[model samples]
Target: MLDAGIYEQLSRLVIAMKQKSSQNMAGNRRSVQKGTSAEFSDFREYMPGDDLRRLDWNVYARSERMYIREYFEEKEAVVSVILDTSASMHYGKKSKAELAQDLCAVIAFLTLHHMDRLVLYDSSQMGTPLVVSGGKNALPKVLGWLQARTFSGTETDSFSAVRQMQRRGAGVTVIVSDFLTEAATDPTQDCLEKTMQYLDFTKQRPVLLQTLCAEELRVTMDGTRNLIDMESKEKLRVTMRADVIARYEQELQKLSVRLKKSASAAGGTYILCDSEKERRALILEDLRPLFV
Candidate 1:
């Protein structure tokens, strides 16, 4: 879904991790382990048998004590991009599914550009999700897989896809969805919190990307209309008015607040994506914080 120019722009960036990875695979990002690297980590008192090369000779000459310099070991991080393929994603004038796919592709490109592992998950996938690792050479497979994705799930639960994933190692997860689960419609439900807890239990730091269409954000319809639930296919007939539209907007605001709070509580961040915005701006500007 990305053009060559977009890929070129993304090549200079790499996905930044909030926590040091514990994976043993060699990579370009810093890890929890200490090893020989250009990036200095800290200094520790030199012990017998310690490599003399790492010893701070100047310190030894001044303070009469030896200390060894340490560097953070670089290791690859696994990034899981979960796309919600629920029918609601197909509702927007500009399909949220398409936006979600593009976002996932951008993340994949960044992860692979930095030589990190990437695992893509979608709700419509029957069993295991597609996993790919390599440099730019693997981008074709990622793009093809994303191209085949279709939003057809009938479940209203956005996290159902995530819940079904096999437990993965410690890493960062990017979940792209409209997040219009039962919790959004019913304030009493705790779907968002529960999903965050699950991700935490899986040893994952989640990045919730909530995509919405312009029509959903601002209602323009007036008087008698039939509302249909994209997922459940439930129908309701009601007279639309100014107060009704205002109430809907209020509920939407509350949903965004709840999602942001839950993501933060789970050691992650929440991003509200407006599908109508330029894709380049979203990836290059709004998502810049994700890259380093």
Candidate 2:
């Protein structure tokens, strides 16, 4: 999904996490727990049995108070990329499912390049996800899995699939979906809220990647036509007048605003991307915030 130049730029970047990871394995990213790394953290007063090697002798000479120098520990992080394959994603000019696949590839490359763990999930099934770790050598496996996949699920709930997966070390959780699914009781926004809450509760840093097609954002065709629901296959006939399209756009904007607000309030990042954009632009510009 990415070109050679994009890969070169990505090599210099690591997956950025606002909160430190709790994984104990040796890695490049700093961990929430303190250990012996070159990076320095804040200091505290030295205890009676503290290590003399960590004592700041210079501070002791000036203030006459012994203090211990601490450093942040580096640890590996797990990045879970969940793809929503619902049929609704199959709509649009470029198709949301295709965009989601491209994003998953980029995320996989970044995670592996940085020596972190990677997990791949999809809405098509509820089972074990393809887990890979090591260096960039493992990238082909991820790509192969993505290539063999297709999006045609009618009633699959990707969030439920995520909840069913065995939990791993707390790190980054990137969800790529259209966020269009609605339950009988829970609305679209409410379902997203509950999913974010669960991710937060599991110590995972949430990163929501919302994909939408150009057609969904704007409707230019005005006439009496029939539209079918991709998921339900329910058909409806209506006159697509200017006013009708205008009202639909307004409501869509309100929903977008609410989704953005909900993601921010949950201590996560939300990015809405159009499927028609070039893969290069999406990686270098739109997705830059995801990297450090």
Candidate 3:
């Protein structure tokens, strides 16, 4: 369960972020269509049939340049929040699955509050898509959907999931997952290339990757224990020596670094979240900048 105070804080942070920058969606966000909004952007040379009122008289008088002021188009964006419900997400210190749900709920609430459409997708259920049109009544349904969901699925095939979402059309795609899927049969580069081809075909809108976990980032486990794959139920038992632990940590860091690089190469924003941190602050301080 999410704390009321945290929810309130998340609301405030989003509000504050919106206030700070009018250009919140300028470069990173794609518009659905052009519309009238009196936010002056740039001056362009007047074209035939241009509005007379938009002509810059001052520039016309000083430099004799027939320039017209252009304003940015204010278009509403559709935000789709995709949460990975795979078994691996259920094993984090603070439960990555729960955190993903909470984050998705908060984002959906904020997007609707700002008059943007919200869509929720669970990869486990490929056919049914949960959509909420931006309005006052949407929040209840969004929250309920998050609460009712149970994370008990097997492995997550992120590339396949991305392809599925793309077929539904373009929008801001926010994917939340640990991204530690089984190695593809093909080379990593080859797999990514194929995925990118599909993503291109569907024209996926701006993508943001959020990886959630606590223990995955830093290992503090000691002594002999059984380490099991949450999805596969495959277990490995071994004595944990200090040297072995150090080597494991190094490998984990390498994997994380590779994942981050892959996301960047795919023209997406990547954010790693420690599940135990204050969710609001983490969202505000680390993730909000990518959107803004």
Q: Which candidate is the best by lDDT?
A: 1
Report clash pairs, candidate 2: none
Q: Give Cα-based local distance difference scores for all models.
A: 0.79, 0.77, 0.63
**In candidate 3, where is summed lDDT lowest over 10 consecutive residues?**
15-24
The residue-by-residue lDDT of candidate 2 on 23-81, one tens digit each, is: 53456776776776577765777633245887889999999999777667776778988
Error of 1 at 277 (Å): 0.8
The TM-scores of all predictions, comma-separated, are: 0.82, 0.81, 0.72
- Best candidate, TM-score-wise? 1
Please provide, for model 3 over 1-292, each residue's C-alpha lDDT reduced to its tens digit, 9 standing for 90 to 100.
5566655555543321211111113322334424457766767676433458878999999998898776666534556667888888888768888778877876776676666556788879856768666454688888888888888899977667766662333445667777677542233445544554454344443344555566776667779989898888999997889898888677666656665555556554556777888876776676674454
User: What would the per-residue lDDT of candidate 1 be over residues 115-146, giving only the tens digit for each residue?
Assistant: 77788887777366887776779989999998
Error of 1 at 168 (Å): 2.9
Q: Better model by TM-score, 1 or 2? A: 1
Name the TM-score of candidate 3. Answer: 0.72
Off by over 4 Å in 2: 36-73, 183-189
